[model samples]
Target: MGPVAALSALGDRTFGSLRRHRNYRLFFAGSGISFIGTWMQQIAAYWLILELTNSPVAVGALALVQTLPVTLFALVGGSIADRVDLRKMVIACETTMGIQAALLCFLALSGVIAPWQLYVLGLAQGVAVALNAPARHTLVFQIVGRDDLTNAIALSASLGTTARILGPAAGGIVVAAFGPGVAFGLNAVSYAIVIAAILAIRLAPRPQRTAPLPGILGSVGQTFRYAVSTRRVAVTFFTLILVSTFSFNFDVLLPLVARLTLDSGAQTFGLIASVFGAGALTGSLVLATVGRTRMLLVLVGALGFGALQLLLARQDSLPAVCGLLYLIGIFYIIWGSSSLATLQLAAPEHLRGRAASLYFFGFMGGAPLGGLIAGSLTAHGGTRLAFTVAGAMAILIAGVGSIVLLLGRSARARRPRTARESAGV
Candidate 1:
């Protein structure tokens, strides 16, 4: 083929997942639209809290309330996903989210919204997310099948990153022009689009399970045990816990970095965030084209993420900070997408929901504690010190994980063969 044709073919293969699947296309379009609003709401909410309280700790506390439900109930969500119709579950969750967003809009527009009220609304939103996340993730597998799972996941991440790029900038404009109330109202409308798309797509019928389902507590325990039984899953979960807890408090970190460190405001914060999203979008596209996941990618991504954070901590200029955040975003997506793909691929079909939930628990469950630590550190020591601590923790976790992985590989290579191998059959 000619050069142009070769390039065109490559592009087709890179995006084949979206082109081949009708349901996924609808999902992609719907989710893309909705996520833009979601991120807008996120930026507005963070800024709103900061405007109201002018305290990083208060921001962290809000984050804690938002994520604590995931920590406590995500396993149950997983259990429910395994037993229920995921389509119905997701629709219900989206509707609930819409209601919550409407309530926030009403509160904000009425001029009676308080910090405590934001917390209550945040908690409500968190519950919907906790219930929805597992089903939403597992639904990708059903839509695209295992062959395209990696690409679908990468595309989905790319869509979300794209939304991040657009949403924050739009949010900055909306907040500056109208108010956070308008942003909340936009988010409320976004959910309707997602619901409409969900209603339009027809899912394949699921096979009924003959075995009895476990109770919620039992289900939670079973997932925990299953995760620990596999070395790779265990290691992935452990690394994620460390990274998510220490490193992924960007909502709390970025605004403070803009205001306190860079001496900037909402627009600057949005710009920095959009730059990071741009980098993440680039990374996700790369993954989508690669069409596969690798644990090595996850490990290297974590290491690079830590190194960039270290560099970010030392930088003072806005340009320098933006540059570092861009690099951080790329590595962050690599780490996150690869880790999730790895865990999902390792899980059996029946356990996939539970496994995904475990992954979410590790990734988001620690946010409460992480937010508290970050807020406290930022309050007491400053943003630089907080970044320093987060970077160091990530590096330490990655370093230890690398050693463990290497030793495990070495031990396996040196071990004696099984009886079947020795029998030469």
Candidate 2:
């Protein structure tokens, strides 16, 4: 094929999910716009906390508050998602989040914003996220069906990655030129756009469950039992917990790395974040086009991610840090996307919501502890030490996981042949 044709073919393959489904298209466009604002708010909030308290521990504390709800309520949210209309649930959650953003904007603009208020708002936002996440995840399959689910997931992730690229760069400029309040206001507006898009989407009605839904606590317990009943799902969940708890404290680490380690300001931090986003976006696009998911990729990606983190810890120059971050982003997304895809694909349709909730429970539930450790280490030992500890732990986990996976493969290879194979008909 000619170069132009090749490019056209790649686009078609990469965006097949969007073209095939109008609902997913609306979701993609709306989320693409809103995620930028969400990322802007994240940058602004992190910076604001650091400026207000001038302490890394405060940032860690904020992180804890922001994630605590997810840790506590995600399973319940999953239960609700399985029982309710996912579309309506997501709309409600998004609306609540928008209102929360408006409140943040009001506080920032009124000059009455305080660390305590941020904490309160963070808690509120966390509630919305906890409830919203499972429904939102389940909604993807509802929109795109099983055949296109992986492509849709990757594309959706790319939207977030794209937002990360534009949002942080723009957030830096916005925070520097105007203020965080304006950024918060913009985030509120972005939420409205997503809400509208959600309203426009029309999904096929979910088939009714043969059995009535159980009580919330019973439902949560049943989901937990189901998730751990399988070896692969259990391993995936365990690995996720380890990585998320030890290695995924970038929100705390990056700002400190920028301010204290590099002696830079918001602009440099923004640049680094944007570069990381660029690499993640590239990875997402690759995954979207390839449309292949495998367990080996997850394992190898974990190893690569840990090695990159170690390398990133040692870099002193801004350019070098940005480069390492780019590489880190690539491996991180590979590991993350592959792991999530595995879970989604393996899960039964009825159990998918709960499985996804379990995934997030491991993913987000550990953040509070990770934030605390990262913040404390950075405050006491320095950014290098924090990164060193995180990198080392990640390497240890990945190494152990690799050995287990390899051994399993070897044992399977050595198993006796079936009777049909032995007969060689």
Candidate 3:
């Protein structure tokens, strides 16, 4: 069959599962709005930082403030999600995000915005996100039953990719038309729409829960132990880290490409980011239609992503980089959505929040470390060298991760050695 015919058939099969569920539709709409605001703030923040410092290192530091909180506090956030009504938790988190954007707008509009001010607000928002991330995923299962869990995950992935395409482009226009502050203010308003959606959702009754009283240190230890104890879970966590460290830093690196390499203005930079978003959008759609829940696809996507990063590193032309970035986005989304679907499905209902916490901890928290490393390395060695290093890191990690997964499978397949143990097994 032709590609279009194949796509049509795939959609016909996959979408039926999604359309049957009303709660999934509501969840999808709310997530889309929230994600759009998220992307808008991200673009505005990066542009503001670049404009203020004109230093790649400073830009990385700004990115750090946005993600470091996740690395530190996500475990506690997961515990909160498990203990609380996750829907209400999302509302509270959204409120915090709205307040953050409002603060950013105030600083920008008042003409009192400093680089340090952005840094502080970014850190504050990051704290809110750390609290929200686990709540967000755990709530997804409530919206769509386990029967459609993989599809819901893919659907959520599509929303992220769609927001990525639209948010940066709109943010650039707003920034160009008025200022960075205007974009931030607009993002704050977008949160109201998400808040309304959350309040409107008719949710299923919650399962029994114990009051989780793990202090920060205890939470961290439990999260770490949980991740270490489960093989599939541990691999999933490590894979997210590998991807974040190598592939996800591309957005943070784009301003460097726009100013130093392409000699493009903010508009061009936004377009470059949008290209990657477009690629991710395509990937998410494909994954949604195909709905692969196996490990094989994840492995392929990881390797494909690493190769795409190397291709991006080799290209200096704006259009070439755009194409490469798109490819990178595509692979990243495919790997991420598939892995998340499997991990979530495998996790026990009781441990879902902790499981998701580990995933976000790897994906979000690892990003700043990657951004810092990429930006600082680029500042000293030049953009090309930085790209080379990033690409190399991705390729290495993908290779290592793939080998580990395969060896793990092989080990699992081996026969029992002890006669008494074998009899019991």
Local lDDT at 126 for model 2: 96
Which stretches in model 3 have alpha-carbon errors above 4 Å? Answer: 1-9, 210-219, 416-425
Question: What lDDT tens digits, residue by residue, belong to model 1 across residues 52-162?
Answer: 999999989989999999998888898899889989999999999999889999999999999999999999999999989999988888889889999998999999999
Ranking by TM-score: 1, 2, 3
Top candidate when judged by lDDT against the true structure: 1
Residue-level lDDT for 106 in candidate 3: 92
Instruction: Spell out the clash pairs found in candidate 1.
Output: none
TM-score of each: 0.97, 0.95, 0.92
Clashing pairs in 3: none
Error of 1 at 111 (Å): 0.7
> Which lDDT tens digits does candidate 2 get at residues 285-331?
88889887777777777788888888887888998999989988887
- How high is the lDDT of residue 259 in model 2? 94
- lDDT of predicted model 3: 0.80
Estimate, for each residue in 1-425, the C-alpha lDDT of model 3 and write its tens digit: 99999878777766745677777677778778878877887888898899988889988898888889998888788878877899999999999999999999999999999999999898999999999988998888877778777777777888898898898888777777888998898889889888888888888788775665566677667778877665566666787777787667866788888887788878877888888899999888788777658776676777788777767766779879888888888888887888777667766676678777877888887878888988987788767777777777767776777788788768866955567434421
TM-score (C-alpha, index-matched) for candidate 1:
0.97
List lDDT for all candidates, in order. 0.89, 0.86, 0.80
Candidate 2, residue 48: Cα displacement in angstroms equals 0.9
RMSD of each: 2.3, 3.0, 3.2
